[model samples]
Target: MPQSETLRAQAAPPRLRWWTELPLILLVYACYSAGRLLARDDVTTAVDHGLAILRIEKSLHLNAEHPLNRLFTQEAWLGVPADFWYASLHYLITPALLVWLFRSRAVRYRAARTWLMTSTFLGLIGFTLLPTCPPRLLDAGHGFVDTMAQYSAYGWWGGEASAPRGMGNLTNQYAAMPSLHVGWALWCGVMLWRFGGTRLAKTAGVVYPLVTTIVVMGTANHYFLDAAAGAAVMGVGLLLTPLMLRAADRVRGSFALRSGRSPEASPVRSPQVSKGPRASIVSGGCQTSAGERFPRQRESALPTGAGPDASPADTGDGAPAAAR
Candidate 1:
């Protein structure tokens, strides 16, 4: 078989253990969160950045959040549900979809996971570079309501970005440019639409991200442009997935080589007896019935008392000689 095919045939399938993935995912998220914290600017800086973005939106005539925010806040019933969806779905749905993919769609799970992770990392970089505030955190003069704070008495989340009371400091409120909420929601939708077993599943995937985008905007947690940037990041990540997988494979192969591990054990050495009237060639040394032992041959070596050009098995005796 060809060497590449041999290596591929011997390669093991990817492992999808929850116990391993859970910790790794948590660690990556923790690092992302911690990095956001370190990158956070003062409230004034964040708010100023947000205002600048809002101005740009106005210039582009794309400030959809104005009407959406007003409409959602005017109706208490609508606002409450939007708040819940914004806070809960991003955390709940994405992970559930990922777990489902890992368990049921093992073949596709790696690409999906890599895409999600890459997009998340890109979002983190955006957070570090442009620490813009979400609409909810802006000054009250801007007319943006803190919907979660308004419904704080109903849910476990405190007023600050759906985090638990007093623990809100652990979260970076300024990481708002490339909202992971919309990014992850869109990722879940894409994966489901692409891999779902049924039409309903695919339709749900399409509807879920759309709903998530509306919820984020209506709840004042993210601006319309933030959602766009989030989807853009996801698109970039998807585009880079093939390259990332190839790089990962190369790194794995290099590591295996450095560790002196072969993909499979060496082929077993067996004795080969010539069917023609010549001596047999045993890969490893073997003994004859006459109690004589023969060692393995070096290509340059000649038999004892034989000329340099003598045939290896030209002895007059009929008995075949062992590989010397």
Candidate 2:
């Protein structure tokens, strides 16, 4: 194989674990759907807990003035407009990649999409369970904007800020405990590491999370803890992705074994038969090994008037028709 093709085969992601993901994704969505509707007690407490953390940070000298406070305070890029990247562009990418995978060789995209989807599902759980309000919502007591609520056209409000169009357009307006932004960036980094051969490309891929972390904090959009949680979630997703791929490979192997026997593993099965030096010949057709002449070849250009048991004129003693 060519060098690039060889490298691609080596770097390709694992096979699809369709059976596992189909049900697992359904279960996850179901649980979250329940949380969205049924867990009012847990939901209320999570929001309270998030508020308590903000208070604790204030008393322990970790308040808005602390360098870590940048996660909830600074707005250095205030001069920029709010329309540059207000929408959740990343969300759009996941669905598009999913459709692309469905139409093409599914192996690579399956693992990646599962990881992204599962992680996003988990993030929704965190949102309802911890209901974090970003720093932009801080007001003056160390003010913070609900980054999830604010939709900046282009400005970087810092803690992975975005300009959401409206609350109705988003899934959860408060799911900021773990920034899926950072998680997807980590995912992209791994993908680049696995498939990108150039050192510079890999370097760029790896450095993005660090920059993203800064952008998120500087804009008061996420607390340091939120970004940490996002990274933790991606780590779990990465580990889960490979386990699924291996299981699918095992299933595919079993299926291929049952399809058809290998060519070399069985005797050829032709039906024509005869006796004598030119016994395998036919009058105007191809003969099978058991003397049953297959009639299809009667019209093809034959050398001359040959018949059943007629040996090739070129051979004095035809040797089993030279093994077609």
Candidate 3:
């Protein structure tokens, strides 16, 4: 194989274990949550950014959020379900797809997981740089309703974002520029469409992300621009995943070197031999018993009175005599 092909084969997905994967996933999620909390900006600035986005959307004739938000707000059936979808699916479906990939399509799991994590961190950077508020967080004068708050009585979430009732403060409500709900949904959709192996999965792949984009907007949790940004973030993450995997491999190689082992080392093997008895060649057309130095000259062939110390001439076999 070519060197590139050899490296590719060597870098194939390794066997996964729940014990290790669970901790890694939890760590990334913890970082994601903590990052949101740490990247929070003041309300005034976030609201200004939100207003700016709305103005831009209006200018571009892409203010789809208004109609959808109004519909979702006026119809309780739509609003309540939209709220549930916005709050629950964002947390549930991403992890469920991850578990599914790990179990059934492990070959693609690592890249998909890496892409998600990379995009999440990138979203964190956006949250820090531009902490834009969601449409629902804007003043009522702006004509958007907080569906989660409106439908709070029906579910475990509170008015503040998607956290359970009293735990609302635990989440950051201003990180709305790049909607990871949409980004993660896109990731899940791609995974299902590419590796799902069934028509139902492929159909769900197309529908899930499309519905999530609408759900986020309809519930007033994200703007059209925010959904677009989320997808852009995922695209950037996909581009960076190969570099990330290569960097990880280098780190692993360095660790192996530090531990005095080569990552590419092959096992040592012994030479094979048959189990049958063996013989040693003494001379042309002659063999000797195992461990014997040479074929002994027959008594009749031996010169008369010649002893064991006789030279090759006396033996007449032309074999060299034993060393003195």
Model number with the top lDDT: 3
| Pairs with backbone N, CA or C atoms under 3 Å apart (clashes), candidate 1 | none
Which pairs, if any, clash in model 3? Answer: none
In Å, residue 5's CA in model 2 sits off its true spot by 26
Pick by TM-score: 1 or 3, better one:
3
Q: Candidate 1 lDDT (Cα, whole model)?
A: 0.78
> Candidate 3 residues 13-95, lDDT tens each?
44568899999999989988887876565888999999999999989989889899999989999989888898888889999
Runs in model 1 lying further than 4 Å from the true structure:
2-13, 263-324
Q: What is the C-alpha RMSD of each candidate to the true structure, in Å?
A: 7.4, 11.2, 9.7
Query: In terms of TM-score, how similar is model 3 to the real structure?
Result: 0.79
Indicate which candidate wins on TM-score. Answer: 3
What's the C-alpha lDDT at position 213 in model 3?
A: 98
**Ranking of predictions according to TM-score:** 3, 1, 2
Query: RMSD in angstroms, candidate 1?
Result: 7.4
For each candidate, how many residue pairs have backbone atoms clashing (under 3 Å)?
0, 35, 0
Q: What is candidate 2's lDDT per residue for 1-324, written digit by digit as tens?
A: 333443444323333465765676567656654544333334455556557767776676654323533333244243132123223434453344455554563646677766766676676667666676555554456544443334343343322335323433224435667876677667766665655568985895687667666555544556667788899988877777677666666665566567753212223334333333333345433443432333332322233455454434324332233334
- Output candidate 2 Cα RMSD: 11.2
